[model samples]
Target: MNINVERQKMADRLFLVAVEGEIDVYTAPVLKKELLPLTEISGTGVTLDLSRTVYIDSTALGVIIAALKSAARNRCRFSVVGMSPRVERLFTITGLMEILRREKIAEGDN
Candidate 1:
């Protein structure tokens, strides 16, 4: 997997993280490392753009949940966007959809 992370400043209190890659056990740590800093930003919100991610495994999901918890502790908003159908299904089957923010968008739209 190829992973690329880009940060865009949406506003003084909001930031967006654009991620591209397959987030499996091997790559989940990359995401965690990239996002850990955001957890320290008290009250600032973060939106994760997962539009380009092709695959994710349980380990990745765990990492994401951990990130969300960290965000909550910091009083920051955490949202996920652009999950592919298969990935969305995985979240649904795993009951993560109810816990994590899942944004619906047409494929290739983002």
Candidate 2:
């Protein structure tokens, strides 16, 4: 799975997390473990970069949605970005795109 989390604090209010690897049942918990604590911190919006992720299952999606709800409960914003085509299709088909935040980043930049 080789999951790597690269965090960039965009400002006092925003933090971006670049995630790389497979986000499936085996690895989704790793993400949850890492991200759950962030929800406890006040007033920080997290942007998860999934550009390098090769796959995601329903369990992974559930974890993400759970994270979003956790963030909301703590008054923090949660977002997602850089989905691969297959991942995007999954989100589309599952109707998760409407609830999750997704963005496209330009090439050549982190």
Candidate 3:
């Protein structure tokens, strides 16, 4: 799995993390390590772009949910973006789309 991080500075910090490959039990920890910290900063906005992510398992989903909760606690803005069709379906089926505030972008656009 590959994770790329970008940060934008303004009145509030914006963190954009792009992921490629599968997010499973093995890779979830890596992603969690990279994302969890951003949730600690108040007014920090996090956008997790999964445009290239091929697959995601339950563990990864749990990690993402945890990140969202942390962001809420810290008053950060968290959003999930660019989910592939299959991943988007998974979120839809699990009723996580609304809770996660996920955004679906065209496959090639991101």
Q: Which candidate's lDDT is highest? A: 1
Steric overlap count per candidate: 0, 0, 0
lDDT of 3 by residue, 1-110 (tens): 55444444434488777777888888888888888898888988888888878999999889888888898899988878788879988887887875654433123322
17-40: candidate 1 lDDT, tens digit per residue? 778888888888888887768866
lDDT of 3: 0.76
Q: Point out where model 2 deviates above 4 Å.
A: 101-110
Worst 10 residues of 1 by lDDT: 101-110
Show where candidate 3 strays beyond 4 Å: 1-12, 101-110
Q: What TM-score would each prediction reach against the true structure?
A: 0.84, 0.80, 0.81
lDDT of 2 by residue, 1-110 (tens): 66776777889878777778888777788888777677657788887788888888898888877877788788887777787778888887897775653432222222
Query: How many residue pairs clash in model 1?
Result: 0
Candidate 1: lDDT of 35?
77
- In candidate 1, which residue ranges exceed 4 Å CA deviation? 101-110
Note the Cα lDDT for every prediction shown. 0.77, 0.74, 0.76
- How accurate locally is residue 42 in candidate 2, as Cα lDDT from 0 to 100? 71
- Ten residues in a row with the worst lDDT in model 2? 101-110
